[model samples]
Target: MSWLVTGGAGYIGSHVTHAMCDAGIPVVVIDDLSTGFAEFVAPAATFVEGSLLDGALVEDTLRRNGVRGVIHVAGYKYAGESVNRPLHTYEQNVTATLTLLSAMQRAGVEAIVFSSSAATYGTPDVEVVDESTATTPESPYGETKLIGEWLLRDVGRSAGIRHTSLRYFNVVGSGSPRLFDASPHNLFPKVFDMLYRGETPRVNGDDYPTPDGTCVRDYIHVADLALAHVAAARRLDDGLPVERVYNLGSGAGTSVAQIMTAIRTVTGIDFEPTIMPRRPGDPARIVATGDLAARDLDWTMRHSLEEMVSSAWEARRQAGDTYPR
Candidate 1:
């Protein structure tokens, strides 16, 4: 059966696309190229340059490709930026997802693997959040993701739409040798860019209630995240359930300072970062419990910090003139 992966040219989506293609699955991609690269799209998959807001286009694409499932991964994802542009967050993430779901209803495409986020949990009192954790999103971006999950849940209950919403934490590392996160919003790419220019990466906050006082996040390699998606797809194919929500993460918190140290260790750069005030809407530490993903999808991450950092560094170097320089 054919599958449609929205935003398949993006970093995480591209990795999923690669994994799907490698498994000999027929895949179709729909992306507007707003923050994604056209070149990053897998050549084996059919690509349609469009927006999720276009309901008619979405329906038509589904019907034409005979798409059996969809992996929705299109959305705005910068916490600080989402706080500033809440309207943009609602429009692209919430509204666009509703449009896509509506189109899915019309097309009768049931199974879907939504790309949710750990931000949906916000800053909890607990160190690690699990699937059962209450979703009290702190930022507009997080709220939008929670809204997307709600859409999936409500839609499934109302209509017979089967889905899996994979809530991911801090997604680090590169997917392919060429496809990298070129977004200015991400931490790893920004840090890599700074170090590449012989400059020290800026530390946003260094006074939190953590070991090093830096904001700590659960870092999962992009490839590991892709494997989780693949596993979810297989589970749905086995006619498991109507809806599932899994937390894809390492369940370990890695501080920003730890990440910087890893980068330095990988690249041998002794660049010292300039500590700045905490960016608005950023929580101190957000890690995952990661039990549901393992139990439900039989998924686990296997990339070390050094390996992840080294891959990202190499991808950054290859991205040289290809990236928006």
Candidate 2:
């Protein structure tokens, strides 16, 4: 089946593109290269350089390629940056989604796998959040993602479109050697960059309510996350549900200290990190309850913390410099 991936040159999107290619699926990619690199797009997939806000471009690309389904991964993602620039985040994350949905409707595409985030559930009252958890986004990035999910849900309620919103936590690891590209915005890549420059990684906060007094998150390997998308695509093809949402995570909370330890252990970098105060809107712990995803999508993450860190390190190493430098 032919597919279109909106942010196909991005970190997670590139992995998804590679996964589809490995499965012998025809794919078309559209990326604006804002944060994504064109080199990361899989060689097997057709690439279009443009933004999702370009509705005409999105529509033309979808119709021309005979795209049966779309995996929407295009948008702004930095939590801290979103807080500093709410309007930009809303425009890119929320407004762009509205345009994309309109374009999808125009193209008569019936299936979509939206890339959502755990941020939508914003500092859940429960230690582990599931699909049934209440959403209270603390950042514009999170709020916009939730808005995108709502748009899909509303559209699905009235239109013939079927959707699966995958709310991700900390998406780690690299896909293939060719598709591996690092983002400076993420924790692992920032740490990798610091270590590469013979500098110690800086931890934003060390006084959270967690065991290590630091924020905790569920880190899922990017490859496994992509596989989960594939599973969701298969389920949609089977006509199981018109609209569904699943939180994609490992169900294990890894703190900042644990991440630092993993990086040093995996990369043989014996460096200490400088701890500072917690950033605003930082959650103490944000783990996932992937039971629903496991039951419905039959998804499981196979890579460990060490495996994910090592893959990211290898990818950074191969890049010769931090991506988008």
Candidate 3:
């Protein structure tokens, strides 16, 4: 049976699709191409262009592909932008997830790996976040993710569906030069786009209570993150024990200033980032420990900061004018 990956044409989803394909796992990708690129999908996988909001289409894709499990990566991912568009966010993330789950149930798909977010923690008071950290999401995007998790939990309990939710912050770097992050909301791509056009990158709020007076956040390689999803899927396929949740984190933090420095070093361009006022509700630091994932899913920080920067920069440069502005 094949595995269905929702949003498999998106950045992180495409990486997971590549990893699953590399692992010899048959994959079926269903994406609406809303923010995802159709060309980003792996050539080996089956691609279905549709939205999860269409329960009929989702169910048909799953049954027709003999899908045994799902990797739910499709959702409204921008936490900041979600604030102004709460209803839209709920429709895309929460309502869509509900529809997907219902479709999965109808299709007899009994396994899933959800792409959750650290935004569920919402300016956590603790220096480092763990799975036990209370979820107090401040944005509609985060709340929808938490609601998705709740849906999974309730379904798992009632329907005996095996599932796990992976919580993470920033995902960077590329495993293939042909694949690149095209999100306008993400930091790495945003900076790379600015540099591509000879525009100065801006750093918001450099006066935070971090080591370098800038916000410290967790950043993990997208390729490495994709591997964990494959591992988790394997565990489920083999009927092995799996946790309800895992944090694919770095167990350390990287400051914004440090990232800028790495970008300068990688690009071999000397340009100071323009310091702008801190955006409201910006947290000083939010990192997580991936100890559980390390033990169960072979999770590790395989790529260094410089490698992350250089790989992402290379892919962004390769995309050139082809990437959507």
Best by lDDT: 3
Candidate 1 total steric clashes: 0
What lDDT tens digits, residue by residue, belong to model 2 across residues 1-325? 5899889998899999888888778999999988788888889999999988889999999999999888888888888789899999999998888898899899999899999998899888988888899999888899999999989989988996899899988888887655564666788878877787888889998888789888888998999988888778778878886337898777777898998888878888788899877787677888897877888777787888898888888888887754537
Per-candidate local distance difference test: 0.87, 0.85, 0.94
Residue 78, model 3: Cα distance from true site in angstroms: 0.6
Model 1 per-residue lDDT at 254 = 92
What are the per-residue Cα lDDT tens digits for candidate 3 across 131-230? 9999999999999999999999999999999999999999999988988998898999999999999999999998887778999999999999999999
Candidate 1 vs 2: which has more lDDT: 1
TM-score of 3: 0.99
Give the Cα-based TM-score of candidate 1 against the true structure: 0.96
Q: Write the per-residue lDDT of candidate 1 for residues 1-325, one digit (tens) a residue.
A: 6899999988989999988999888999999988888888889999999999999999999999999999999888887789899999999999999999999999999888999998888878787888888888888999999999999989998997888899888788886679787878788898988877778789998999899999988899998888888778877877885336788777777999999899889998888889999887677888887787888776787889998998988899998966654
Which residue window of length 10 is worst by lDDT in model 1? 241-250
Ranked candidates (lDDT, high to low): 3, 1, 2
